[model samples]
Target: MASMSDHELYPIGDAARRSGLSVSAVRFYADAGLIEPTRLNEAGHRMYDIQAIARLELVRTLRELDTDLAEIRRLLDGGTTLHDLLTTHLGIVERQERTLRARRAVLRTLIKQGGTTAQADLMHKLVSMTDEERERTIDDFWTEVGANLDVPDGFVDRLRAMRPVLPADPTAAQLEAWIELADLVSDPAFRGAVRTYLRDTYAAPEARTLATEPFQEFMHGSGAALMEELLAAHRAGESPLSGRVQRTVTLFLEAVTALSGTPLTAEARDRMADGYRQIPGILRQLDEEDAAAGGPGYGDTHGRYLALVAAINGTTGQEHDPIPYVWIADAMQAVQPA
Candidate 1:
């Protein structure tokens, strides 16, 4: 604790040299209000005491570490401690590293996609969306695709289950699948196809609510029988239109009619076949995209939705493996009267 009068002061040039900073750099920091001098020399030159020398050294070190000027100013003003600033800086650095890693992942996806600039741009957007924003994308999709349609019981819950929640640190493959899924849902043709399928599946709001119970009943009863007959036919090497196949197809169509509470006319059955056909195609497309991106295939949304609906209707054991819907539809078509 030297007396005020005994404390030595150095001019800016000497201070800069002692701190290993250039004179211009010292002037810049002083002018930026980052460093304050103890007094001005008679000629109006800046003069700093020992405390200022220590502060200037710290300022220079912080600048070397690329700390923001405002942050440094706060630190010097005693508004924040060095530990606080460093902790915040570490968070910023980590976020920057995450962004760089995401960019690298996007580059790899672009290369795998054959360097398509449009796809690269799309992938970049996918990676950049915040979690809330990504969730909104799914909401928007369901809104557009399910518009004015008769959604089954717990439809929203099923949609939520199918939602893609991208990980905070997504891999290249995950990003790629995200981009593809975003593209698929954004397509007008895709939306229209899903809309028509949904409309045909549940023709009215009343039917939508009633669909789960009868559907579960059919699935548990006649649906199981049809599947057994089909499997038996497959094992016997019989064509889908063979007498045995036609019998089971008739039984299946009758079961569908009973569930619908409507006449099982030719046109109605055609619509049913077409509706079932749409889902497997969509599922196949997602599966192909996931495979190309090296992702585990899209989680089984089609089956899961069905299972959820059955569960809500108090149906269990519906998880038993059964004949593919497409195979059933094809057999139904094959057995249709000329």
Candidate 2:
């Protein structure tokens, strides 16, 4: 149906020149089925009509955009839409960008912290966790702590609620906090402390004596009473060695006695007071955890747990103020055995 002029076709060289591509590129596209030549001259040369010239230009443009030949062919054949291709590629680009950003932050933080290998390893581990992975880390800690124990209903949920949900784009400080928290939860000493708290709170049925009530009620009463007393002492600036502050040791002992479901003897009181001496040490650990977490956000998950347990057990001593604990212990030691 072509007239003589209409059948005029460009050779591969002319087509490549018009499309700003090399002759080899045009030949490659043709061989790749991306370009269908209008005809083959008798001399065995590929010839392109106006339509073929336009297709060659499209192939050249797609190649410049980094589109693979097969994908370009799919686009040209209308087998795939430009929108779908770009959308899928865009998602991939965004994810790569996010990963790059995280890596950038990790390196930056590592350098600022003196570029130590240990720091780099730790930060890299923290950076590798996805949001879900971070959540699982917290869950795993609680799981380990709660294993083989009669954890009260809602206790694990409360602990989960305290978990810090690290931001998708975290700051250096947040990263530091996350790193510290992750390390803390993995510590054997920390896990043992948590287990000890759980054991004391939920005394095993076989181990139960007449000295204790239900764990929750005891925790609430003991926590409320101890907190009220300590916060008042804290507010009043009472010296731990003062007689007035020391006398409150009896109140503390009574609360412990009420929970233990046993008679409050001088020896039992002394042992309980000895246990209270550990409060200052534990508080020091919590303070370190808090400091690492950049001073509290999800309220220091470990700190919250310890504070709750301490309050319930009537040993709510401030980390920096060991006076109350010292006073209580001294007072208990002074009491004569009947």
Candidate 3:
């Protein structure tokens, strides 16, 4: 053809504008062999046709997704499908999102607590630890606690199995939980509490007897439906005090009282309610003066500590709901206690 219509070709500036790239970028892509000038204009200036403009636009989009230049070229050459390119980049973005969220949570915690430089350094280090390091830390914690534990009936084995596994792409809450767990386990007090719990709760004769009670079996049988409903709420991150949770707890308490033939006395119920009310305060009163200041919230019990471990491992299941026992224990002191 002797000449081309204006609509069929674009000047370099026009092509750059249409493709959402700077003039230099369009020229660079051309130099990279990803695109090319269609022809020279009457003034001998490089120009691109409609097809070249479309290719430059695709390059701009892929680059915006953090695609490397080589990958972009592969995509241009039809060496990779668009679906493959997008799928790969989507995974990259998701991983980046988790990393950013973890970093943001760390910064937020520091900001919220007015954390010391040492605290900041520790938080950073804990969040950055390799998987092997995390496992080693957990192992050390268990080793110390295990020395005092005499739990039988596979309890010790199950407890040991619940070590943190921090997921390949952990949620913000999971990352936060792991940080607190790391801090908590590194504290001697927390390890001691675990030992004390194992001795006082699991190894106790009456506690062991209670473990095999008919009601315990009922809980896993008839009560599992209610338990699973509450568990679903927990997994969805619903507040324990929500109306739905209250209803579920009420149902659970009724079932427990009926099955155990132990009507919760009004006094016991009052004590339980008072205990539950104190939980929020107790959780906040954790070792504020130590590295574990943000440690083991939610009643500040080893129960919460274990919950954090379950969270990082993506294995929370059949979690105990403590608030309802408040609706059921009717005891109290001059002040609330954990």
- Tell me each candidate's RMSD, in Å, in order: 13.9, 13.5, 9.1
Ranking by lDDT: 3, 1, 2
Give the alpha carbon lDDT tens digit for every residue of 63-113 in model 3: 899899999888888899999999999999987887798898788778877
Cα-based TM-score, every candidate: 0.40, 0.41, 0.62
Worst 10 residues of 3 by lDDT: 329-338
Q: Write the per-residue lDDT of candidate 1 for residues 201-259, one digit (tens) a residue.
A: 46766457545755655665678777787877876777777888888887777677766
lDDT of 2 at 46: 90
Question: Compared with the true structure, what per-residue lDDT tens digits does model 2 show for residues 90-139?
Answer: 77777776677667767776666667888777778877888888778778
**Error in Å for residue 249 of model 1:** 30
Collision pairs in model 3: 267-330, 268-329, 268-330, 269-329, 269-330, 270-330, 271-330, 271-331, 272-329
Candidate 2 wrong stretches, greater than 4 Å = 1-20, 37-54, 64-66, 115-125, 130-132, 140-162, 166-338
In order, the Cα lDDT scores of the candidates are 0.70, 0.67, 0.72
In candidate 1, list every pair of residues with a backbone clash. Answer: none
Identify the candidate with maximal TM-score.
3
